[model samples]
Structures are given as structure tokens and as C-alpha cells.
Target: MQATRTDQPSASPVAPPPPLSLQTRMVLLSYFAYFFYYFCRKHLGVATPAMVNSGISDTTIGWVQTAYGVCYAIGQFLSGALGDRLGPRIALTTGMILSGIASLAFGLFPIVGVLVIALSLNGLFQSTGWSNSCKVVAEWVNPVNRGKVMGFWTTCYIFGSIAANVVAGTILARYGWHHVFLFTGITVAVVGVIQGIFLINRPADRGYAIELEERSSPATDNTRSGFMLMIRQPAVLLLGLAYTGLKYVRYTVFSWSPYYLVSSIGLAEESAAYASNGLEIGGILGLLLGGWVGDRFFPGNRVRLALFALIGMIGAILLYRVTSGTGGLWGNLIGLGAIGLFLYIADAIVSGIAAQDIGGAENTASAAGIINGIGSTAQLFSGIVPIWLKQRWGWDAVFISFIVIAFFSCLAILPVARKGKLTKA
Candidate 1:
């Protein structure tokens, strides 16, 4: 009766975390690199009011954003492949420097045609940041702990958005809007130079052999075969479709919320910019929680968690629409926070964790690029359609559209959720 069970196998040992110094270096580098990427990207949104006041129509400004989105979407595919081939270190540094130059051009020449061309170039360069940074993380970190690691790491964008708004708002208040672009461009370029000097592309470069999960694709290098292989995955395609709706919702909020506050709520320009921080603050929390909960509770099933978050996002949008008119500043802030929390929970899972899991070690950047590229297409409409809706049917129509988009985003993943996990096809 007291005999021990000798035939039963013991549980497998959990892998130890990556080397502390290497992990720290990778995390900090990727975090800051992507963080400054936002500086060049988000400054346009902050400076929108000044642009409008300078006799640029809202529709024209929307078209400028649309131009940026188009090029950004196209660049995702090319940059993802480049990251895989040339190494993320080169791709990332080049993108940052070039993006900075583009921003400078946009600021120096504020004419409509120049604004379109500059922002378009900026969009293309800005595309390099995410996929390459993702490739670096995939190389340095093991998949077992990737969810938690990427969770905190992904907050770079959220924090970047917050910082960009604060800095841009302050700069706009103190100096003219032109200074916003000049300062951000200079800052990002310097950071790019520093990142180029210090970034280590992979663990092997540092003489460490980190264990990685094997993927089904043999051509995992930054080659055409690998790109095709990743694009063919059903999960990747589904995730991309879902991300389209999600990105539309996110870009709309990011691009227009300040305008909404100023125009609809009667807030001053500076106040509108500062209040927008509430969204990013909630996003930071969402990403952290999503990463922790996905790894701790769901393990390999990030899509399921993402589905839950999508549903929550739908609810938050609805709540925001209902209360925004009567809720005042506090109400708007609360709604924005709630919307950010749920939206980003789905966002981080779909674009970051799930993409990593599906792509594994080999095609990390390609998978991310494909998914994000598809999602970025929504930015085209996000930039222009909100303006159309607001002009034609008012703000309520715009939010109603977001609610519908969030619901469809949730539905896009239902088939994958039924399969019960994210896996390569």
C-alpha cells in the first residue's frame, strides 16, 4: 500500500531563463529602438491642430496620413524580409535614420505636396522598426518565456506614445508645431546611431547557444521560400484579417481622439494632447496583463486570450460611445482608458505573442510583417474614413463603425479559436 509508483515518469524540468546580461541588453535595446520609432511616427497626430490652423483642411490632413499608411503597409513586407536577410541590427538602424530624415523634410517644407511625399517616405522607413526588432527578440529569447518577455517589451510603443504626446504637447505649447518634428527627428536619428553601434543581432553573435523551438519550415532564413512558407499558414492569414479590423480601431483612436477632444469636448489643444495619454497608459497595463495571463494561464493558446480581449474591446467601444457625450472630461478619460486596455490586450496577443508562436524561431519577422502588413492596410481607411464619417454623419457614426469592426475582429478569430490554439499550418 505504501509502495511508490516506480513506472510513472516525472515531469520535465522547466528551462532556465536566458543569460541575464544578454536578456537585459536585448530587452533594453529593442525597447528603446521601437520606443523612439514612435517619436517620428506619432508627432504628426499631435501636430494636427496646428496643421489644420495653418489652412490645411482636415480632409487634406487625412489624405497625408493615408499616404503614410499606404507606404507603411507596402514597406512591412519588404522590411520583414530585409530584417531576416541583413540582420535586424542593420535594418533597424537604417530605418530609424531614414525615418528621421523623412520627418525632417516634412517639417522643413510644410507645403501639401511636400508633406505627402515626406510622410510617405517616413512611413516606408518607419515600417522597418517592428519586424526587425521582433527578429532580434526572437533570436535572443527562448519561446517558453517569450510571452512575458515580449509583454513588457511591447510596452515600448505604449510608453513611446505617451512620451511622444507629452513631449509633442509641451513643444507645441512652447514652440510652434514645426519644432515638434525637428526635435523628434533629431532625437530619433541620434538614438539610431547609438543603437547601430551597440545592438547584438543574435545570441550566437555573443557566443551563446540559446535553445529555440523548432518550426516546420525548412527555409526559415530571410529568403523567398521562407516568406512564401509563412504567408501560406492559415493561422497567419486569419490573424492578419482579424488584425485588419483591430488596427483600424486603434489607428482611428490614435489619430483622431485628440481632434475629438478639441472639437467635440471643447478642450484646448494642449489639454487634448495630454488627455490622450490616458489611452496609452491603459494600453501599457493591458499588454503587461495580457502577456502574464497568456503565459501563466493559457500557455500556447494566445489566440483564445486574444478572442476574449476582442469581445471586451467591443464592449468598451460601446460604453465609450454611450457616455462620451454626457460624461465630460473624466468620462472621456475613463472610456479611453477602458478602450485602450481591451484593444491592446488583443493587439499584443495577435501582433506579438501569437505571431511569435506561429512563426517560431525561423520566420519571426516574416510572420510579424505579414500580420502587421495586413493590419496596416486598415490604416488607409482609418485615416480617411473617420474624416468622412465625422463630416457626413458625425462622431457617433465613427464610433459605431469601430464597434462593428471590433466585433468582426472577434469573429475573424473564432475559427482559429475553435482549433483551440495558435499553430503553424
Candidate 2:
């Protein structure tokens, strides 16, 4: 025999991963990024009443809200593209910077024209939020464990809202609303800087494996296609339609619940503020359930979970109208909380898991952004819907309009249900 076998090739030892893997760091950083994003974003919502007291008309206020919605819609689509092509870290950090600037601008200029312009800027920039979060979560978390991890991560929305309320309430009570903007802007900016330093785009970017074990599927990563590729998917289109209809109720609640309580239901300002927590609390619960149902009950049937969630949301809206004015302050608070809880089930499934199921990973952000952006376009109509009803009818008229819109939202999901079926795990 030849002497070739005398020397054996040596194998390199594998390096051990750090105490916190890249995925762990990325998850933590992503939560921070989104937490601050919500803080800056929700400030506008809490301050709307104060804005009204500053001389803005309800219609004008609605218009200002519309400006944010319009820009946010655009941002959603564009940021999805950016997230797919450039990576979520860059897209998200850029959005944070933009939102922070918008916050500063909102505080600096209290004029209607200026406020509208600034809010539009904020909305457009922050459009990056949802797409970026989707990309980040998809990157760091595995499919199997994603349900629970996402539950923890998505809780940022509620915590962010709570932060805004606590900070806004105290500051607005003492220093006034402008300070709320100032504090929000400053704090969010600081968090943004930290995110820029820490958040990595994917496990591969830093040499690690994702945490969850997903069902068998090809990878969903890359920047391979254009906007048209995203729009062409039937799943994207159908899902978008359902979501668009659904948001009429969702955005309405976000934008106007406080005003609705204070003006129509006759609750004290502080009481309305506390009651507002109901929405966030309910949302937290709903999202948790949605994730569980998607994993266990719906399992392979992610879309079915979405349909059920949407159904629950419709029921919640009906409950909202029925219970809103029935008992008094306590009743309104409890009713609003229930709405928050039930409505968020759809929110978690449709926007979170369903987006991934239909769109796949490579174009996930883009596809999801387009769908959610289009669906969220209903925010514009919802913005004006209440005003029209109130101008013509009264608070009662507006509440009736709420009922009608909720009913229409229920109808929108029928086609979606027809198209997609859930597969059990």
C-alpha cells in the first residue's frame, strides 16, 4: 500500500457559543426597538384630547390622524421592501430616528398644519415598525417556539402603551402635553441609539442558529423580488382584504377611545386614562391566546386561526357597542377592556402568523407590509366615519356608526375564509 494513509487530516474544533447567543441579543434588542417605537407612536393618541383643547377642531383632528394613517400606509409598503433588501436592522433603526424627529417636531409645532405635516412624517417613518418587527422575530425565533416567544415580544405593545400613559398622564397633568412629546422624543431617541448598537439582522449575520424548531419548509430569507412579486400572491391579496376591513374597528379604538369616553360617555379624564388600559390589557390576553391557538388548535392551520381571531374581534366590537353606555363609568371601562381582548386575537393571528404562512420568509416583510398597509388604509375612512356620524347625528350616531362598521368588517373576512383552510398539526 502507498504511504498516503500514514497522516490523518485534522478536524477543527467547533467554537462554543457565547452565554447569550446572537439570536438572544437580537431578540432583546428587537424588543427594545419596538418598545420605544410604540412609546413615541402612542403619545400622539394620548395627547389628542390635549390637542383638541389647544383649539384643533374634531374634523381637523381627524384629518391630522388621517395624515398619519396615509403616511403610515406608504411607509408600510416601502419599509417592507427596505427590510427585505437592506435588512431589518437598518430599516428599523432608520424608522426609529424618523419617529423620534417627528416627535420632536410635534412638540415644537402645535399648529394644525404643522401638526398634520409632522404626524404624517412620523407615520411614514414608523411604517417601518411592523415589517421590521416581523423580520426580526422571524430571524431570531424558531417556528415551533415562536408562539410563546412572540407572545413575550408582542407584549411590548401593551407595555409601550402603559409607558406612554403613565408618562403622558403625569407630565400632561403638571407640565402640559408638549412636555409629553419632549420626554417621549428624548427617551425614544436614547433607546434608538442603543438599538443601533445592539440589534443584528439575523442569526447567520452573527454565526448562530435560530431558537425555534419549525415544520419543514424552505427558507424565507432574501431580497429577490420587486413590489409586484409581493402584490401578485393571492394569499397576500385575500389576507389584505380581511385585515383592511378589520382595522376600521381596530384603528378607531386606538385613535378615539379616550375621546369617546371623555366626550360621549362622560368619564373623568383620569378615569378615561385608566380605562384606556383595558384596550392594552385585553390586547395582551388576546395575542397570547391567538398564539396558543395558532400553535395547538390551529397548528398547521395558521389561516384558520386567523379566521377565528377575526370572528372573535367582530364579536368584541358588538359587545363594545352593547356595553359601552349601559352601566356607567365602570361599564364603559369593562366594555372597552373586553373589546381590546377579543379584537387582539385577530390582530395577532392575521398580522403575525398568517402573514408568515402565506407570504413565506424571503418576501415576508414586503408581502405582509403590502397586505397590512392596504388593509390599514381603512383607517382613513374610520377617521372620517366618526366625524360624519357625530356632525350629522351625535355621539349616539357615532356609536351606531361603530356598530355598522363592525358589521361590515365582519363581512370582509368571508371571502378570506372561503379561500384559506387551516391544517391541523
Candidate 3:
């Protein structure tokens, strides 16, 4: 009996770490892909003031943005399912290339109707970036380290936004607003081509052992069942609801902060664009900290950490509203940075970490799509609501409304926080 112990060992051998070279390559490529995707998407906001100066009404711009939001929301659902079916490499490559084309078209014709149509197409293509890119990370990274990994990985957007501001701002100041789109559009298209050539979809494609358990079966292989499976999960629904509020605030800030600085605080367009970078800079730090703390201390739990950050977000928004106009540039910078810090911690956790946890390897992209889709529906309101509020009440009312939204966002996740921790579906 004692001699039959060959199969029973004192301990299990640890799996070797995933190949660092492959992981790093995938991460860097996806990071830059999404990074430039923001360039095409965000330059519109930077150019809005110039557009207004050229005789466009706030209402017209709002409608154009609303069109983009509608298309983007619909595309999130479709692209997510497609990513699952076709694989991330194809989905991501196609999206980035098309988005660049749309952006270039927007710059070529300055008509309001043309702007509406072009940005709508741009929005649809832009929707493809996040869910598929997240899917890529989910496929390549181990679940055990996903929080920390995605934490750092999600910074692509934050830094992307910052870079877009700097680049777009400088271009607007020197060449013209039209050149902003032309330059960014060409760059993202090139990046997409490079990614299509080199990017691998999964570790197994290259003969490495898959790090996460893949829960795929023929029963849940199709789009409808995968969507229903995610929707049925209580955590997914609650996270989606919570993400709606967070995204509304985030997008509103992205779309309007530069305008606010220019119109209200008396800053030049380029200066305002540079100042807006404070938000993303703060976001970079917050995302990194949230990922590290959640992975190291909370382990499988992310909701509780997000709740704390959401509460902090409420206070930060209040501080930003109160100090921004009175405190001058430094005050405005500090306030925006503070809001960014808290908002992104919660944002990264709910949108990235929690979605991955619930979706596991099989349904990661679909789950991201559903959650982000629901959240993106708020973009419809984000485009019009602040303009409506600011027109009717004042900028103070805009801030107050978002404060209420932040509070409700906290409420949405409270039930999940009480239950403690999520496991793979």
C-alpha cells in the first residue's frame, strides 16, 4: 500500500507562469489599439468650441453627439457578440480601420448633416474596441492575476485620452481643428493594420496552456443564449445598472469639461484642452491603485472596493463644483484630478474586473458588451442632459444632477457588496 503512493504526492506541482514575452506583446498591442481609438472618438469634444465659433448651435452639436451615442450603444451589443463568434483579432482590426475612415470623412466635410452621419459611423466602429480588447486580455491573462493585470491594462484609455488632448490641442492651436481628425484618423488606421498582422487570439493558438478555465459548450455557443446567461446573473445586472451612472458622469466630463473651461472659466481652447488632461492623469493613478489593492487585499472581491470609491466620487464631484471657478487653474486642476481619481477606481473595477469575473473565459466579451451596452445607453443622456441642464438652470445644476447620479450608482451596487465576492459564471 505504501509503495502505491506514486500517484499521490505530498503537493501539486505549480503551473509555470505564462510566457512573459507573449503576454507583454499582446498587452502592448491592444493598449495602443484602444489608445488611438480614443483619438478618433475624443477629438470631436476638443473641436466642439471651434465648431460653435463657426456658427453651429449647441443643439445641433448635441444632436450630432446623440446620433453617435445611439449608434455606439447599438454597436456595443452587436460587436460584443461578433467578437465572441469571430475572435478578437478580426473584430478589433476591422473596427479600428473603419473608425479611422469615418473620422477622416468627418474632417473632410464640415456640414452639420455630414457631421451627424460621419460621427454615427465613427461611434459604431469605436464601440468595437473595448469589448474585443477586453476579450483579448481575458484570453491571454490568468484569472488569478486579472484584476492587477486589467487594472494596468485599462490605463490605455486614460493615457489615450490624455495624449489625445495634448495632440489634438496642439494641432488645433497650430494647424486647424480639421487637421486634428485627419492626423488621428490616419494614425489609428495604421496601428490597426499592424495589430491585425501580429496579434494572437488566445494562448492555445500559440501552443501555450490556457490559464483560465474555458466554460464554453455548444449549448451556450450562440449569441442569444450567451446574452441571456449573462443577463440572468444578478451580479451582471446590478453591475450594469451601477455602470450606467458612472459612465454618464465620465462621458459628460469628457464631452463638456473643455467647453466648460472655455465658456465659463475664461480659458483658451488649447489651454482648456491641456487642463482637461488633469482628469485622465488622476485616472491613471487611480486605476493602478485600485487594481493592486483589489488583487492583493480583496482577492476575488471587487464590489466593496468600488463602493468605497463611488462614495469618494460623490465628495470629489462636490469639491470640483465648489472650487473649480473660484480657485483658478490650480484649483480646477486639483478638483478635476480628485474626481478622476475616485471615478476611475470604481469605473475600472466595475467595467473591467467585475465583468471578467462574472463572464469567465467563455462569455467575457458578451458580458462586457451587455454591461457596457447598458452603461453606454447613458451616453444618449450625457450628450443632451448637461446642455439642457446648463441652459435651463446653470452649470451648478449640472454638477448637482451628476451628484445625484453618483449617489444612485452607489445604491445600485449595495446589494452585491453585502453578499460579498463574485465567482466565475
Candidate RMSDs in Å, in order, are 7.5, 4.1, 4.9
Candidate 1 local lDDT, 1-425, one digit each (tens): 89776987999665554588977898799889999999998898889987788888889879878988999899998888777767889988999999898888877877788788888778899999998888888888888889889889989999998999999999999998888989999999998998899998877676666788765655544344557877988888888889998889888877888888899988899998988887888898999999999888788587898899899888888888888887777788888899899888889888877877887666788889999999899999988899999999999999999988877888888887767656643
Write candidate 2's Cα lDDT for 173-270 as tens digits. Answer: 77887888888887877777777777878766655554433433445333756356768766667667777755777676667777777887787655
- What would the C-alpha RMSD of candidate 1 be, to one decimal place? 7.5
Instruction: Identify the superior model by lDDT, candidate 2 or candidate 3.
Output: 3
- In candidate 2, stretches whose alpha carbon ends up further than 4 angstroms from where it belongs are 1-21, 211-222, 408-411, 415-425
Model 1 C-alpha lDDT versus the unseen true structure: 0.85
lDDT (10s digit) by residue, model 3, range 297-411: 7785888899999999999998888888886677787788999999999998888788888887667888888888888888888888899999999899999988998898899
How does each model score on lDDT?
Answer: 0.85, 0.71, 0.85
Residue 354, candidate 3: alpha-carbon lDDT: 84
TM-scores for the candidates: 0.93, 0.88, 0.94
Candidate 1 lands at a TM-score of 0.93
